[model samples]
Target: MDLSFDCIVAGSGHAGSCAALSAIDAGCKRVLVIEKGPPEWVGGNGYFTAGAHRTVHGGLQDLLPIVRNATAEVASTTDMDPYSAEEFTADIMRLGNNQSDPTIVRAVVDGSRDAIGWLAERVHIPFIFSFHRQAYLVNGRHKFWGGMVLSVEDGGKGLIAAHQQALEKAGVTVWYDTPAVELKLDHGHISGVVVIRNGERLQLSAPAVVLACGGFESSVDLRAKYLGSDWERAKVRGTPYNTGDGLSLAHSIGGQLAGDFAHCHSTCWDANAPADRGDRVLSNQFTKSGYPLGLMLNTQGRRFVDEGQDFRNYTYAKFGREILRQPGGYAFQVWDARASGWLRMEEYGDDVVDKVSAASVTELAEKLQAKGLEDADAFIETVAAYNRTVTAFDEEHPSVKWDPAVKDGLSTQSTRESLKLPKSNWALPLDKPPFLAVKVACGITFTFGGLAIDPDTAAVISEKTGQAIPGLFCAGELVGGVFYGNYPGGSGLTAGAVFGRKAGRGAARVMRS
Candidate 1:
């Protein structure tokens, strides 16, 4: 069977959704989005995110002015100190170990802010301003899954329900549960896609195709092959459907892949442990009480890293690899009453005390049965040693500072000012009593590496010559080399918007030409 449209977008995650919407906005009369799985409530990882976004124009100077100017209305001041383009680029280069494509990185940074603004105007996505000065910060207040949610919002069905009221009103055709199985290429140009609908396969012809399928985080075999042995053992916290369909599709068509070697964010605790599957208790407790404070110790009971650093930094992957050397890649986080008090407030809140009880250090250790350490005495001793070291350092150093700005430092300033323990008190010690310990397992949200694309328009590029694959484009995690190593707070969503728009607009241009 065969069908034809102006454009066909594969996958229904944030990137695909944005590509469809942007295509429609760019004046494409016929656009069809293909999603493989059933529509789900959570809507993939976008719903689980803390929702931060950024942009620092470095190499894409020609387009920087357009994006910067377009994003002016939604740009918010941040308390988090900003890194200059050079600093940002340097940080990315260092993180990527110089493996990333400089042109792709520049395009992402240059188009970021404007993409946020575009999504807000098009979908009524709400954003909050950050108090930090150095960084670009914004709040995503769209209902459940809007804004970034629009990209993969159940494969654009949700967007079709709300904002796409305008699209339908404007005559956009959407096909549900249609999975793109093959790319229809003719004479080195993408002509369409072969899709399976209701188990019936059909060819959907189009002038251009956008492969917006998500990354390969869900495929354990692929994770082992591309990510390494460590990712093979890592727990996944996001969608199980993102199995690199886009990457596979692009590769089959001779599209180049980039950033296939980097990862962002690390899990200190696997809240998805089988024993705790249905219980939000673990997450609730940790987020409120802050049980994972102070120095984190592996099974052998020794400090491995500075516990205060943001977990999002891929550096945690190094710690994860180290901990996996233990019995099960598991570790214990020890803290006292004061730390517990803060953890309760920060992680679980006061109400969790009623659910899980441990009045003393020994009792807490007994409850958790922490590996390596025998009982609460061992846990208490570790806490004492940590406190002693903290005190000695405090007296000797007098002042503590982070080289680059810390995100969310300002919103948390009131808590810091009240503690009066120094700026590094953000790096607080576990000095108090009746301590707590919880076993943490490392988990990954999604893989960062994917297909390489043209930095100028996000069109999929050939691996041989680094030239664009005509009639093909990509965005979000499916297109790599954009996010160096560490993902700027909200780049995932922002990237989808920015590159999705560019890919859509560029595809429209190809069709018109």
Candidate 2:
């Protein structure tokens, strides 16, 4: 069999799929994608995502032509606000504490819409309006919030299926159970790669290799080393194949390590989920991101972080880290009957999670005590104090209607009985029973640290020479400095596509040169 190829991409995930297609688009005839997992394990972390994509657009009308889920009747009832390039950029910079690399941020933000467009047109991704996740019906109209509105029809599984169809159509060959173990460097330039296939190591010759495998989030040792001791206990939220293979292959060849090594994108996941792998059928369903509509309490039954600190898109990524720091590496989300209805059924459906509920706060505390709540009395007192603050605020602003579609400032801080750590938005009195709660643990999505790359070309940057390595390119979670402490909800998929396209084109150009 012929092993000769112009460009060989590592990892058969969304980023690698985009890179393979883009390489073909850039006039490269022979391209190969190497997959680390068996034939069953494809799409890497992308297979476990919600398929949300955040891009700049002129609200609903601009997106109507691209999405299949929107109809005349749905558009009439939908109220979507325009999201601008500036707003997207500010979100990353602000969430990253202004420490994110400007060039990387600009590349992902500016290229998002076009990358998504390419995925839709060339890859035939079935785009949808994401009404279930991003919008809530207020009065009559479905109002969109958090600046993310586009997704695929059936989430990540659909995304990967579409990519597989496109790859077959494009004549891009994919080798399953083949993991790129090392980058072959000749005279300070990447020559090809050495990979393990079917229990044997083989060397493949190619001028260009695109590394889009993933980060070190799945490695228990690496998680303890970089993200801290508490993080070692965090649950893996994606493919178990992403064990920092791409990052290792690049860094072994002097690739610069940048971004927040101590930080990552995590969220409140179901406490009962598997420790090291995600459920293939359930996918991203274990993600408990409904805290923005309720409250989070530690084992002591006290509020830790402000649940309404920002939009769930902006805050959910880092909130998992907060949960890890809690006692026993878990927390409980408290919600009343009113706000519980607002939580997505995909995540909080009766069959999806094992939730504990009671008719009163006292009874709820008693139920939670069996689930490992140390101080049931403290939990009861906490709820009482929070209710008092919300009641006080509601009395002062009686005309204010509680709307979940926006940051309806029904705050607890404005009241005289406000707790020190206030629920700054969507502060509703948890008076109505039955009160409900779900046990959650930190679910790590990906690490924030990895190989640095040139923003323009997606070529991996050398630490020694401060220049792009001749034949080495990377995208997806392997390209560091695009995110820091946290990230916006839908931006990860968009970033992967943006840099994937650049990496593929760069690899093709490297071969041609």
Candidate 3:
């Protein structure tokens, strides 16, 4: 097979696939995708995702086309509020504590809707409302309030397969089990790449190269070195292949690292999940994020963080670090029957394990004890105190109002007298029958830090020279300066698609020149 190409995309995740598609769409005939893993793991971390894609849109009208199965009755009742570019930009910047690059954030925000539309219309990828993650039923109507309203038809793996099929149909070649080892520089510009395939090292020359591989989340050495001392203990949430090859290659050629290297997109994952990538059958089901509706207790049966401080999208990323800091690098999410109903169905599939349930809180505590928890009395007392001190409510002001976005329910009104951390909202008395608990541990999704890139062209920028390398481009988790302490849910895929398209076009333009 010919190794030479006009453009080479490292990795075959959402970003790399989009980059390859855009390059071919831009008339670059020779486009090849070099994937480090085999075909089963071709999607990288993107394959494990729920396929949520955040984008700016003008309410339900703008959403109708992409949500292909919307019935007339559903369309009439479902409410999808307008999410503007300004709102998207503000949310990203504010969540990053103003640490994100304004220009890159602006570009991503402005192009998100177009990116989604392009994938749906041009690439023939189907989209639908994200019923599991973003929608809520209220007063006989379903309201989708978060900017994350749409996702590809069959979640992340399906989405990746769909795009890969589309690219293959267009005659783009994807080399599996081939990893790019080094960037070959020609006169200070990236001219080619050195790759390892089947025990042989081959140098593939391309006029332009796009690095959409991933970050260092899967590398224990890199995680401990950059993310903190104990970060090596965090569970890996996706594919083990994202060991920061692109970032290291870029750094060797003077690319500046951007964002806080110590921060990552972490979450509350199942304690019994595999140390590396989770099971493909369960996919993202290893996550247990319904903490807002219940209590997260440390080993000693004490609430550590306020469960209802914000929406799950705003708080889930950073909470895994806290969970890791607890004793034994784990915790338990306890909920009653009411909250159990609200638990995502994905988390309770046939493949799930490590859940404990009982008819009473005391019995639940005993069941938890058998699962290695120490004290049942302490847990009983904690629930008793929580229920006793919960804020009073009457028929007029109910405990929960079913708001789709933000904290919209009863909270422990003044834990002012208690030393324990309080539940800020959606704090119902855990007195219902059939109490349940799930063991949880820290799962590191992706590292937030990576190589900085030029906003306009997605070109890799040199920290030393403050100039973009002529033929290098990047997207996906390899591009930094977009996130810091936290990330809004569904934005990662959107950012990937947006910048991937830009990087593809930029590389194609370079190759054409």
Best by TM-score: 2
lDDT of 3 by residue, 1-513 (tens): 677899999989999989999998887999989999888888988889888888899988888977766888888988788999888988888889999889889888988989999989877777888766777777778877546788777788778878878998989898999999999989988889999999999999998999999999999999989988788889999999999999889889898888778799999999989997767777788888889878988877777889888778778889998999887788889989977887787875446856788999999888887666776788888888888656343133553554535467566655244335667777777899988898899999998899888888899999899999888999999889889888888899988998899999998899879
State the C-alpha lDDT per candidate. Answer: 0.57, 0.91, 0.85
lDDT of 2 by residue, 383-439 (tens): 889998999888888887787888888888654667899898899988888889999
Between which residue pairs do clashes occur in model 2? none
List candidate 3 stretches off by more than 4 Å. Answer: 391-406, 415-420
Better structure of 1 and 2 per lDDT: 2
Candidate 3, poorest ten consecutive residues by summed lDDT: 391-400
Task: Name the candidate, 2 or 3, with the larger TM-score value.
Answer: 2
Worst 10 residues of 2 by lDDT: 410-419
**What C-alpha RMSD separates each model from the true structure?**
7.8, 1.0, 1.9
Highest lDDT scorer: 2
Runs in model 1 with CA error above 4 Å?
Answer: 56-91, 130-172, 262-265, 273-293, 309-326, 340-360, 370-380, 398-425
| TM-score versus the correct structure, for each prediction | 0.76, 0.99, 0.96
- Clashes (N, CA, C under 3 Å) per candidate: 31, 0, 0
Question: Which 10 successive residues of model 1 have the least lDDT summed?
Answer: 141-150
